[model samples]
Target chain A: MSAATEAPLLELDGLVTEFRTGGAWHAALRGVSFALARNETLALVGESGCGKSVTALSIMGLLPPANSRIAAGRIRFAGRDLVGLSEEAMRKLRGNEISMIFQEPMTSLNPVLTVGFQVAESLRYHRGMEGQAARRAALELLDQVKIPAAAQRFDDYPHQFSGGMRQRVMIAMALACRPKLLLADEPTTALDVTIQAQVLALLAELKSAYGMAMIFITHNLGVVASIADRVAVMYAGAIVETAAVDELFARPTHPYTEALLRTIPRVDEDSAGLAAIPGQVPPLSAMPPGCRFAPRCALREAECEATDPALAPLPAAADHRVRCRVRAPATAAPRHA
Target chain B: MPEPMLEVAGLRKFFEVKRGFPRATTVTVRALDGISFTVGAGQSFGLVGESGCGKSTAGRAVLRLIEPDEGRVAFKGEDVLAAGKERLRALRRKMQIVFQDPYASLNPRRMIGKALTEPMRVHGVGAPGERVARAELLLAEVGLPKNAMTRYPHEFSGGQRQRIGIARALTLEPELIVADEPVSALDVSIQSQILLLLQGLQERRRLSFIFISHDLGVVRYFCQSMAVMYLGRIVETGPIPAIFKEPLHPYTKMLRDASPVPDPTRKVAMLRIEGEVPSAVNPPAGCHFHTRCPHAMEICRKAYPEWTPLGDGRGVACHLHKV
Candidate 1:
């Protein structure tokens, strides 16, 4: 339980990210907060438009051109607040101390640049190692990622590499500086199952070897189960539930989380006819006044519609937190389950 | 067993590629080297594989959407590949296809009613009034409200649009519907809704399906039996339970190992299959998967392994499974 007492490597408290859409500023991520310990894997799992990516973009300070910005919250990284940092200061931190990887490797990697040059360019820019030093380091990084015949394929273009191999190059570039924190946004979404496994295995191995903390954002729960030490289930722009990976799956505290875990069919087990959560995520503009998930919640009470429930720790578990009216509140008996 | 509902044997399709503009040498992509399978009537058969594995191509080749260079596609003992344009059109009414992308498949310019009714009108199924009635019934069957008939595709969400696509596929009352990655684009919550809906429809209509998808979980749930395709060949084919429990082919076993169970106690192990799938344009000699296979033998690179049938209606194409 040393992790319980130790200071988190990255702590986001009450992160409220806003996006300017249709002449209005809407909060896409409403008060998302989580802590990542050193060498920990925190999986941010949710469906599209659930603010999983927005949280990453906000953390990375790579929000889109429009007025998308973090309106509130403190992003403390190693005792330093990143929210108020200048672009120049943030730029220095990025790709050196904090690295990020996107889902689409084909689009993320420069098509015109050679794989070796792309990997080496980071080493040169971030580490100031030029010429042969950068090239040799790049080759070593590629080999570390287990790309077959890394020496021979140095000059190969992005188009020449397969989807899986191109992703390996992306990983090599991200790991070139050995950042303390890695923000991977659905890194293996576009890959085949086998290729995704290979990438994930490589990522896990690298994460442990480098002793880096990660905020892995993905929509797939199965992938989260495999790699994540902790899981944060988000819905409609807020963290609905957070728990240790095994405990959360064993006893899901939030109704949304419960529905979500039961919804998808698993390859390993026979499916009990899938249970749907019914309606879609509410639009940002038409966000309801009270509990955001009330309309879709099965155990919706009159009180649930009038007052918003703050995320609180579950009664039995100190670490597990949930933002649901039923099945979580210490005062409220478990009604839904 | 009465010639099966559909039988595809030794289906082959090739694509030509040219590199340079002036003096480009034409390269041949043997997309479907030779794949064969059978789908019983009222049964769902899965075509599982990763991207560029030719599962989609095989699905289309069976319906002659992309005419194969060789092999036979028989539907209910009728030669589908040999059918003329008129016969093909008639055959198409019996074997419709549900596309992977629901949003792109439907015409935005037309109303949902028009899109659903057009299929019935093309086949001259009934009078104009009856076709409209049938279209509404399809909407109801696919879990969409009747008011959905007048709305355009953009009005509905991805899941609703997919339901509309399923409705459109069901319009002609087709016997066999080819659902190509139907739920891949949907959210996990909605994916099961569609899968359940599809299963209900399958039971009620007795629709035989050629279910093609990359997600093995969805395939395992929806399909009774499946054929695992790799570089355009069925590496393993068997009942879903047996295949899931004990896969014979190295590629098939790797695929199973690669799929992560939604349980944190189960961590995905190190990959046994290495390297990316080779380009289909010039597949390797002998076993196409030898480049990545962990158990590749000396003979694997020289000669293609013969298909070994293990008497339980299950089989694999691998040197290790030689019988």
Candidate 2:
């Protein structure tokens, strides 16, 4: 889809985010880097406390200002640097050019306000559409997201709608401004499996329909396979593996990614036992000195425990990359600018 | 089959809810409607369904945690519902439950050792000193450190807390454990650890489990037989691998197809059914799933489908399956 030659819609070069905890700053995201092509769906896959959510928050400029800070790195979005952007400028850009939908739709939505008003409010604030025009647009967006009887349910408050329907309302509001980018963090995790499929399908359709690049953050690899064009597997606050969706599934290079794939019980096949990752994720405050994953990695060598690995492209496929000292060592030079 | 560990028949639990602002009319919420299943000795029977489909209610009702409206729950041929208070209390020793949220189920202020041993203390299983030793042994069996006994529930991670919950359930040496979504709250990596631990315990202890969960993959992995519930009714019930391979009921088929497989080769099927699950209070007239069933007919909408036995312990309730 002409994404190859086009400039990346968003790029993060060595992004580091830290939070002040117990009088000390601990990095949650350690030098994370990725480039999102226009209209591409990049799935950020990781377990909790692995900094996937933090990456999304960093991009949205929504991190808690009191304790969290973007210690280092540049977040360039649509030809503009967002790391140091003022709140006023970011606010205008947020709903207009970038929007996000959270996991719990009920919490994200205002219970007091009607769903229609919430959707219309974004249009009014961002696009200057008012009154009847805004209402009509909001209803149309809801219909687009396949909210059944959208017009009739327009005046209903968030509490009136079911879990799946509330998620649809959230999507409609996020899409109201017709943003260029959408950051969705576990948008369907709370819904039932059937409803999750519905929401995922809706997201895929809308992503293509709007031609918007999306950063879908989720711990579910199944969801990644369904929606992602590319995937970045994060582990202990670092991108351990990155590849096209098919390639990542076919040949997961990073030990963490491989272990994770094996750990999940598959619906399609039967296995004797799930291969559990040996230990829990290291807490941010007590992160390993060298390779973050080395402590739990099966193939960890002595060298891995001494120095962290660089994220380098694989020799077989240039697009596929992994941050592992043993698996995909930095023998080959960096190819990307 | 060794008289089966547990047999539930016509289990029903209903709650009356008052709705509306000014005039609240009492409506019966049929959380569990005449659902039944049997868990054989050392067998794991999965009650699979979405939220509000009564899987959780059935689990609780079987244990008499929620009194059933109309049902016979026989634990090793002993009538659980008809048992006396003293008899029921004794029966509870052999049938423990593991809740979905371990954190919520556990007393945060209580020490992990105390939580583990308190049940034995209540049941008068052993001396106070012996209970403490049993608690330590249980912790070791669940792969937690003996020292973990001294820590509070809040100190441990979600996975560790779940292990503690498992240990507490085993204090009475229960034959049947009603594990309700035990791993659903944990991360995928941690989920596998818990699953493996549960499997190990089931194998070692010969524990019969009423594993209630919405995850088809997990249910398929752990359960030998399963009952797929929809709107408080069993739409399909059969042996796993087989039922999952060729699901007879439309609702079961939809659920299987909707479950996202890890492999990207098989694209998630376009949802065959539309609209969220109808509220239990106002479930559709005849067959509860008729409204959303892809192959629903006039007959399905007119009368609830009878459970047609397909032999070999397999059955389905659907108009299309009628002879």
Candidate 3:
């Protein structure tokens, strides 16, 4: 309940998550570390199969049962290590201390139950409110999300709501507990452009109003550029770069990040064709050595194929950092110091 | 100027849904209500709209993929709707389709090599070795590695599989390709790559395209002309700049406003349209978007607005532009 200045709202220190597939273990998150400051919006930007969602799930302790395991690293929440917490302990944190909104609202929300009931169900379970109290609270949350006629639509099921409205309900449900941190995984992907904009703005407003630290995971640079305070570029199960939004966009250090920015269709510049990364993000099981992006990187060199790059700050900036074999060495020591 | 490759006039496809059982209540969905447009010999025409607005259905109806209940479709001056099965089959050589979901559209069991050559074989355009050579050329043309020929749909990433889909669609060497949300399923970075590939193929093959999508940004980049659909009908049709800069239709304005401005500093007031899309089976009586239009007039609620041209090849179906 204390201010997050003592420790981050959420911090993953050298987190490693793996899965057993094809009779062998596959590393989904390899020595990943990051922190979500209070009221900050950190975007995890990556293409499909880059483990952004997996990282989010790992933070929420919602990994699938198959062969999923957080092999190493500490997840500190309010200065307490949550990595080895029991299932009951973790469940207590979910929705009360932290909450998450999934990508597709249609699938995430209960179809048969009334949306009010579904939203209220979280309140009843977490805050121990029942029946009328829960319903009133749910209506209040919906009104807070600016859903018109919230009280009148309390009995209407999820199918009765539009895509955008359903997403609002989802956001309302996620924020019902007033959690300190919120994780949104591609919440606008399924909605139309207009609806997507509304949801993004609503999330921004809610984050500010609640003073919540938000981890927004999305593949759209446009979305990231709009809402993210800081951007984390991920490729093939690794954080390639992390920087303040303006710095990341203005001067991308890693070639992968640079190529990604180039590949985006800009309304300003006139280009013959997009600068493609040339190859797909390699399969997690068959990750390339040295640099995970070397095969697809345009600025690859001989040394890139021999060793992995450690994420470290650039010479000029204190916070901006990039992971690249050519640009960043394994150790932080200066080359000529 | 070269002759138009495709022309559509007053195209209408209505679906009558029978619901409830006492005597059977009926409702008519005006999916594509009297929409008209044309694509030049090698120009890309984009049709964009939210889901259930009937953009996909319109594309399918244009190609005679689905039998339209009304209106005219002409491909190279031949009436597509009136054409017989044999004529339509022959016309298939001039047109092909690439679907939005690459994995769903492509046969997962078949290898990429086979999928690329199957279309060419169906058209009986080349010999086995010739088909293989053409397939390899297409794979390379889409910027796929040579080794990708034998890979199955599951083996390739979403981007690579989309490239393979493009290669397959290009194998027939059709003059026009109806791409239905082709890049909507991929990442933003990969989407640009696919868009660039599509643009390149358009230039080299001199291919015309009917690109259908919901993203206005991508459409603006790829489409030479634009058409905005609402609840199953075209509300606005014009050049890209005209539509983006000065959208005449209320729905088009909302779409523009809704698009997330890449810059956080510039706050664009989203013209939020109230109410959900009316049931397709039982759409509103007049002006399909009237129920949700912010500037809906009384006439819009009672009578269907007439589609009028605003000159210079721009037209909007709205009462505000009745003049």
Candidate 4:
């Protein structure tokens, strides 16, 4: 649990993003921060509207320039500050050094264009390959993603492929440039369970083979357990806890993390009953005065309502951090540790 | 032994798809090809499958919401498929259904009270004066606030709206409720709450449920018995705990194994079975799953496997248990 001296492949420090709605600016991401090492997968998990996708979009520079702004923060990728990077610079880095795959590939992809052409476009633009050279690379990319009859299907349009195959094409495009970091936002959620397993396994294999670090965003905890090296639990626009996949599941420090774990019905074994969190996520526009999760948290006390809690590292395990005053006491170290 | 509240036999529903647009040849897509299972008086039966596996179709077909080409659906030993319009309409009140999407199921513009009372008004269950009081009572029964009746569907969260849907189902006092992926759309916390509410309602009302879902965990917890469908056929049907402990069919085993267990350290044996489901229009000649089964043999491709019973209502359709 000691601090890692080595530099991470990507890091975000005190990132705050706001959106202008109805002429009023509202903060959607409040002081969100995390880091990912090369070849390591950090699963960003949260409920709907928890800013999981927004964080990914913020990093991709896909957020609306007119309404949303990164008010304060540092986004350092490979030791380079990327907060205020010019659009042209970001374009050069995006898809070449970093690529993103969304939840529904069918919608994300251009329907008219052949998937092969779409996948090859990244190669031609990023690596400057031409004609046959690009086509060959695209076919190889398709093969790597395990698309059956890759060569034969190259000329087929997006509609010709199925949901699972379309996702593979999306992955082929994302990995075309061999990006150092891949931001996958619920990439497997739309597929069937068996197909989801296939995609997750493919992603795991691809990550290792290419030595690509990834920020895998998903709402399913079971997906996080197998696919992630570590996990960052986000709630109400900020991370409530960050721990190794095993530790977070084993001993969740934050009340929200604990409740989230208890809510999942078990397939591996019998569960007495699911313990649901009492209330809904507070509306973002009219948030509570103190801890964002205080209203729903069973462990919430008077002091928790009076002051907002900041994410703090537990002394016994420097890597395990929790943003909870009542549930995680600073003085008392983790009992198991 | 107590007679099951609902019974289905050799149910089939097929849709015709036109391939190659201009010179299109119509092909039969066998959505629900002769699948059958039962639910006890107050026990839940889960129907689990992927997108095109026909679980939803089966639910709709059993309820007579969708007319099936062939099948025998018996509720309380009465023929459902052969029932006349008046009889079928009367039977509908006894067998209701809850849809998956809470938002889409409810009328957004109408108040929740009116939405709940409309069924009773059509069935002529109660006096006009009693419908309003009944709506409020049903709302509270599903654990929603009394004021929920006056609010529109948009005002409620996904979880609350689901509760409203459940309440609407209860308004008819149906003996069996077909809940199609009822909790799949909500957050995990909200999903549990709905599951618990259903569990409590089942205990209190002695209501049987046809629980349909892609999520094995939720189904395993909610349904006492289950049927795993593959390519429109029930590959396996048995008690949920028994199936979970030891899956007999390769397809069911693959589904169980593929389900992501929340435990990080539990590494399930990775089966080599691959490929998405083939089009149902022209399903593999014999066993529909033979194309993707890890232990598929030559005989599997040559002939369709017969349903083999393993006693205690546990059965499977596969060549592996041909003895």
Model 3 lDDT per residue over B106-221, tens place:
88899899998888788788999999988998888988877888888998888888888888888877899999999998877678778888988999899999999998877888
lDDT of 2 by residue, B1-323 (tens): 34599999999999999987679899999999898888999999999999999999999999999999998999999999999999999999999999989999999899998999899888888999999999999999999999998899889999999999999999999999999999999999899999999999999999999999999989999989999999899889989988988999988889888888767787678555586789999999889887777787898888998999998789999989887
Classify candidate 4 by CAPRI docking class: medium
Output the TM-score of candidate 2. 0.99
Please give the distance, in angstroms, between residue A3's alpha carbon in candidate 4 and its true position after superposition.
Answer: 11
Q: Give the TM-score of each candidate.
A: 0.96, 0.99, 0.92, 0.97
- CA lDDT scores, all candidates in order: 0.89, 0.91, 0.84, 0.90
DockQ of 3: 0.47
Model 1 per-residue lDDT at B30: 81
Top model by TM-score, which number? 2
Candidate 2: deviation at residue B252, Å? 0.8
Q: Runs in model 3 with CA error above 4 Å?
A: A1-6, A267-273, A325-337, B18-26, B127-133, B143-151, B267-279, B282-286, B290-303
lDDT of 2 by residue, A24-103 (tens): 99999989999998789999999999999999999999999999999999999999999999999999998789999999
- Candidate 1 residue lDDT tens string, A202-222: 999899999999999998999
Number of backbone clashes in candidate 4? 0
Clashing pairs in 1: none
Which tens-of-lDDT digit does each residue in B1-323 have in candidate 4? 25799999999999988787469898888999998888899999999999988999999999888999998999999999999999999999999999989899999899999999999999998898799899999998888888887899999999999999999999989999999999988988899889999999999999999999999999888988999999899989999889999999999988888888878997433335498888787789989999899989998999989999999789999999865
Prediction 3 TM-score vs. true = 0.92
